[model samples]
Target: MTAAARLLDDVCHLTAQSLNRLETSEHFRVVKMLGEGSYGKVVLAVHNQSASASVCPGSPMALKFFPRATTSLCSFLREYNLSLRFCTHPSLSRALGIAYLTPSHYVFAQQAGLFGDLYDFIVPEAGVEEDRCQRVVSQLSGALSHLHSLGFVHRDVKPENVFLCDAACRWVKLGDFGMAKARGTKVPEVWYRSPYCTPEAETARGDGDGAGERSEPEEKKRGPRVWASVEPSVDSWALGVLTYAMLTGAHPWPQTSSDCGAYLKYLHWFRTAKSPEEELDLWAEPQHQGPDGTPADFGAKEQPSVAPQFARFTPLGRAFFRLLLNPGPADRGRPEDALGYLGGAWVPVGERERLEERRKKSRGGGGGGAVNEVKLKDGRGLR
Candidate 1:
């Protein structure tokens, strides 16, 4: 049997409630793997005891299991504690309890996002409909604001890390706290560093592309070696990127940090003063052209003189992007600023209703949304 199988066999029958009492961790009747990542795997589990079950209401809880070999005790504790500290907020997944079945297995239960993560909803290239995107921005922005107020920053904030609570995206939660760090603490550069969204690069520390070393026992090579202060601005920048991505299928820039042309173009679009070298670089970059020699990608028809990237979003969307992706770390606005745009036409009501129609067909469906007939795998839900 595999390590996971051993773990399941060991704890599937226990009714314990806390970490020290693994032998009594409830009798988990069913366990189905939901997703897996480098850190560990998340499984949807249901204990026989309903009232004592993790309060997911009508659904089973998600138990993310980490093996001792992969997740260090220190790392696990930090993530667990931080998650619980912010559990009071509706957008942050609550850590119900923890258990240590063996040196090889450690597990923690939390509210499950049965509808699946936000990445599933994003339509590649075209992006999500406006109202859907707006809903996500609203919930996640609030979550980030709450975390920042606590002086902690979720260094990694991308769509893949966000879980949806409903089909129309009216409710969502930002998951994966493993990369979250307290501001001012020098942490391994675990954030996505691409031209599309280089919040840390815009800051002084990561600007030079200095990689930091990981002090872990092994596999410390996941991110760049350069360590820098984890600030709230990093999350803000990520929100900007997420917003842009959800609004427009394409990223603002490519992934490489060495692309001078991409960075120059972005800077120009942002209206930041470029240095002499940057100006020269922007000048040297040639315009994209088609076989007929006309401009390959024209800017928005409404604003012919603007950058093509600006064509991706509406005027309101652009303003929201700018607010979250200010030039400097401290210059960025709070995530709550997104709440202001919630009433705007991120997507028209007519189209948003149509989008809602399609979401009803989703297999995973969602909670309390247009997806009225929530058909979960375990056949558990409200009629």
Candidate 2:
């Protein structure tokens, strides 16, 4: 069997064990279903058995079940690869446990996170203060800066993908790495498909359609391989759409055939060959408009009024947006580079003093449970 296939088989075996552990062990209890999406359902689970006895000591966890369909299997593999690559980040969601239930189904258990997605926390379905919006943006900026630094592209970076810990709104974690990918790979996931996808990339050609529907001259030269290519800038472009969405609660681009298509159009219209500074003007235009046709008053000139909440960002934040939303990959910064900008200003002086104090004061502190490892059929351990 291929290595990937064997790994899948091994995961399937371990998934059964994980489920059994939950059923019998006192640590994690499956309470109820939190939410479900095309990828998997999240459950409200907690650790019933912990050393510390604190009120509501246990938190909720998301249990993602992967189906065995050809498409879902691919997604399952991608999520696993991504989790292993970037799970070390404290701000990013941790992959606590992974197990496969069937050839087509796997259960991924993670820490029961804080409140629901960021959408609920940001603009209340009812109403919210504008100050609250600023707080959300700042926290998200920090999280995004972290992910971007790890060479990780969160392809589906929408408000809905962010989860909150409490109403204080201090802790924000990025979720749905189902669409995330390493920088060099073919763009991962439908959400990040290049806005420039040719017809072949967007539309699946059936055997009934015949082969002659292909039209690109490049396709003829490349002999069928050049038809639909997914690109890396695709994620950066998607980042622009996401930033616009969090600010306005709606996609900046038109409602079109696909998010990718709308994004591509947005890019073509505003990003053509503009420098990063020029692209900010494009980002500002949408922010400047009111719900109605009139432009918003920024108190100064006719410049787009940035949400007052975004005011605290240093030049690094602006630089990050410029790098992240750069029209071309050549200008855009890598995820790690962007992260460096976020932490660049903070100097960790007296770190040894801090560690010495921590060590002296805290002798025994509680940490999270151990992450169980699953061995692949080939004897590789998935930790």
Candidate 3:
């Protein structure tokens, strides 16, 4: 059987068994289910049973089940692998490990962050502010900068993938790296709020002054395809949409319930706003006429302007939307450059140090808090 097929069979067989009974590690105990998504199921588990003999250190953890046949398996594995690649970042979630129950079936484990996702937090019910929104955006952009510099693209940059844990979530943690693609490779997943889609270039040439007809491939292979394919800028585009939602609590473009309607709008945005270079010029020369030959408007009383939508943002925020979301890849700011614009101003070392310091204090108190107390007869007891 193919790898995918074999994996599906293994998943079917293993899922039939009592998954709750499976012991991934000696330190944690299976508690109960937490939530389920398109990717898989998340279970709330704790280390209550292993305080005496547990070698693992955390108090409680989350267990994520990734079925082989489901799209979530690939996404889970992708997150597991990429998380390892950028394991040390404080703003990024720590991936514990992966457990392959069967040849094809597996579970990804990680240290759980406190809040669920930004989407649940930033809705009309939550009622956040502009400065707070800017802080979270800065943290995410910083994290994205790190990821992009490491040659990875987070194809999915929606609020659902960003976790907010600490007070006010002045601190931010990025989750769900399943749709991320390597820097140079093309990913095929659909994006909902990305302003920058991949650009497809069509070089048009014809006879000019007796010159022979010449043509070039509109789609370039080495770099980003301008119109047809979505590139890394899609992340920036999504960030813009996110910023808009965070500030105004509404979508930049019209939102629809039907998948078809939503997609039509998405495509329209993709085709119309495919070039970032042009967008930058719009801000640079507001008084100049556009290529379609119409004067750009910045002072229209009824319409929103870049200056105002970006008023509450820092210099970095303005640059992020302008350059990072440049409709074209060439115009869009390089992830590193965009991050450099952020500089050291928005360092994201929120409560991690405080929490760790507290843990040390607690452990220093000589309570039986050290998780390594279980004296295995041998150095290694269970494999």
Candidate 4:
């Protein structure tokens, strides 16, 4: 049997056992739909277990449901297993349970985020706070380190895949491992991939140029194929992209009519650039004119410019971006390197102390009793 077929068989056997255990488990209930994607639909749920009763009315949970026809059973099983393995980490989302609801469908459950995904937190005028952004990068770096240590690569690492555990945006967790795979595996031909894909992935897929146009000799001379075997470095590349997006309300590439257009431009630039620094310089440079002979900055008034945000980054931050964004997998920075560069503290000790103090003050009904909620551009809570 094929690997996928074997995995599916194992999943079926495991699901059958889980179903038997779930018969007496009547505490879990779906609350509302959280979001939907090509993989499946995610919903907010509550488990009325006695252990969690003291904390809140219902123990909040996030449940992902995949229709057997629409989603690959093997992919679902992969994510379920990975999440369960890494869930103990503070920065990694935990898998609560998994079950096959019917022969045609399956469901996976986990702890729900109070705020939501990172995309919901992004706004036009103002982006996430600098401290919060640093915290997120640090936390995610730790999470990536853990995953890399296990010899896995989270192929998809974008804003939408990251979840915030609290309203304050103090704790962030990496989620959605459906696209994850073992290191050195052949990259899958996923149609609906994140725009934050690395240069290697783009090149391997022949993203910018027509696939048939490139000859094998030219490809060989150019070094590895763009869609080279998947590596842990792809996650690092995505971390750089995600950091830029969070700091600025824009992508690192020039604005395009569609995400695909921008992604193509990103790939083309990376393909031609001599180094990661050169690629970053290209993104930092302002566009001059378009084919219509009109200034490309016409829409400046509508959206916040990424240039200013890029300017605000510290020297260490800029270096970190360049390191992770390197086109070559070998040159790319590891998660541990990022953690060290961000200050050898996985969760900064001082920050934790401050947060604890705030919580204590709130509990005592002090003047500063409100939770330090992170606000969106419109001055609304991230929730």
Candidate 5:
């Protein structure tokens, strides 16, 4: 067997042994199903007793159950280990504990996100507020920076993976590390990745078939070969795509066939000599040509607004997006760069001015207004 196959075999054996021990322990009780995915089911859970007596009991948590039949042991271990390593960060989800439930099952308990994911929170009619968008992206940058500092890159970063702590979305955290990989490592061919993939990743096709589709030798089908170099910039690229989605209610690239067609369009745009802003503006136009010479109306339900919402972004905000969305991976902004931009005057002036005005009113005994501040449970402030 190859090295990776051997390692997977070892993990499977160890997992079986761990589950045997956990079957005798009684530390958690399942409440109800929270969500279900292709590989596993997540459920609301409560700790019966703290992992230690010094800690409190009855704390609510989320238990993600992975069945051996559908989920790979290697991916589960990667997420579990990474979660434990970076849980201290307020913007990253905390993995409280892990336990084996059965020979074919394992469970990981993590901090529950009260509000749903960013994908659900966004609305087409009204895109996310500029201030709120800045806050979410800022926290995500911090999380990505922390992850990079730990020598890892989140291969998948999208709205579905971003979670809110409250209904107001004042505190946001990045979760779901199943696709994360170590920096400088060879990109795994068999990995499951989000559609909001980086250009580098999309272009690194094994067989030159097309972007986003896997091409490998028949013998390598099981484990899949690693063909591309992994880097921290992949995460940055995904963040750029996410930023565009949040600012505008639609995707930056065309959403034609719901397959790799959009990625192909992105590739074409990247090769074009046109400016980034001009390329982005093309999304506002109807892509699908009609049978006649005129532009085809995809119908009111299918068509996004012709006017690009990104025009509303402040000058600095536009610059920030450009920095992140640079077609060249080496040219993309690092997490620290994003943080600096966010802390600087790149954000909308109204947001900072409004916060300052709110502080003044509170100091003058006018009482605090409806101004919202993003703070973590540990008392650390995001902004």
Candidate 6:
């Protein structure tokens, strides 16, 4: 038997004594692998127990298995605690149960996203319809806001981590809490962050904001505490990027890194909007016009207002997105602020059908799940 087959076979024969020191339930029939990540793999499963006490009978679930040898139990516990802590929120994927099968792996079950993730649903050069985008952004806004309120920040927020509960995206949830950390904790290494989602850390030179390795003077500085702490605002920045990406099927900038010219250009534009030397202009926002010739104002601040990448959104949407993507951590208002822009269209309604058609085509483009199709001795693929 292959090493993979033997490991799973060992798991299949789990008994009550096989349950390590963790809250666990009955055995499960592994159907097929759903996906895998750096830490472990997730498989689709259903309860195999005949006992009347089964919480779910035939319903499918996503079972995440972390091999003990490759993953630390403390990491597993952290993710589980955080996931269960936020499970009550409607916009978060619920944790079904958890188990530590003696020798093979530590496993946990979560409600599955059968339709796939938003990454699969999004198309390049053209994004989801405005109505659908509105629904998704609103849900994520709520989810992020809830997380922040609980003093945590979801360090990763991108299309791939956002799961679709349905094809039309009427219901979506923020999943994959492995990178999540409490506010005020030391931020993870830059290499661990999701590109374009997390803000680029200030360089050692202290180029932009001036509080790093070389301050006003290295001597005057008490110490070179360069790395930043985790802030709840990161989720808002990521949400804004995700919003614009989903609307235009492209990123506003490649990423917020100093190395990228696109990001540098965007950074300059963002700074210009906040420049005190520049004169303020009160321009009428698009789609906010009343019956009269005058525009109805919703009190949005003045921004550069002419980003080619964000042209897909209306002036109103751009204004809100600017607020969300603001580089200044203290100023990047709450994700709940997106609620105010929820009533209006994010993108033009005329392009809805075209966007939907693109989404449909992308969904049908089949590249199967990330399963390693290894089979057992019986030739039944390890079920």
Q: What is the lDDT of residue 157 in candidate 1?
A: 79
Write the number of the candidate with greater TM-score, choosing between 5 and 6: 6
TM, every model: 0.70, 0.53, 0.56, 0.64, 0.66, 0.73
Please, what are the lDDT tens digits per residue for candidate 5 over residues 1-383?
A: 23433443465466545543364137777777776765587787777776543235888787887887767666776577567545567999877745555666767778888676786655432345556777888889889988787777887687767888985667998988877776777644332233354555543344332324444654365344447777888888778767766654446553212255645544443354245445335347446544432234433422232223333344345556666777678888886677655643332344334444544545476442121222221121111
Question: What is candidate 3's lDDT per residue for 1-383, written digit by digit as tens?
Answer: 22433443455454435333344646457676756765677776765443233225545666767667754444545566566446456677666543444444467566676666676544331124445676776788778877766666676676656676764878888877766665556323222212222222211111121122224542232233222333557577667666655644444333211233543444454354424344434346335533322333423421233333333332233445566545455656654455444332211122223333543554466432112221221111100
Model 3 segments more than 4 A misplaced: 1-21, 24-27, 30-34, 48-58, 71-76, 102-105, 125-127, 187-230, 255-320, 335-383
Write model 6 residue lDDT over 214-273, tens digit each, in one string: 455753553444566788787888888778767767666654666767666666666655
Instruction: Put down candidate 1 lDDT per residue, 36-142, tens digits, no spaces.
Output: 76677888887555444445344577877777787666567666656754556788877775445555667777778888876666654446677678778888888
lDDT of candidate 4 over 1-383, digit per residue (tens): 23543453466457546552242137567777887765668888776663432234477778777777876656666677668655567989887754446555677777678688887765432345556777888899888987777667787777677898885678989988876776777743322233354554543343333223447787576555444466888788778877776655455653211345654544454454334344335346455743433235534531132233232343345556667776567878887777655552212233334434544444465332111233321122221
Which model scores highest in TM-score?
6
By lDDT, who's the top model here? 6
**Candidate with more favorable, higher TM-score: 2 or 5:** 5
Q: Locate the minimum summed-lDDT window of 10 residues in model 3.
A: 374-383
> For each predicted model, how many residue pairs clash, with residues at least 3 apart or on different chains?
11, 8, 18, 4, 0, 0
* Residue 161 miss distance in model 6 (angstroms): 1.2
Question: Candidates 2 and 6: which is better by TM-score?
Answer: 6
Model 1, runs deviating above 4 Å: 1-18, 21-26, 50-59, 188-199, 202-226, 256-260, 272-305, 346-383
* lDDT: the better of candidates 2 and 5: 5
Candidate ranking under TM-score, highest first, comes to: 6, 1, 5, 4, 3, 2
RMSD of each: 11.9, 14.5, 16.7, 12.2, 12.3, 11.1
Judged by whole-model lDDT over C-alpha atoms, candidate 4 comes out at: 0.59
Question: Which residue pairs show collisions in model 4?
Answer: 203-226, 203-227, 204-226, 204-227
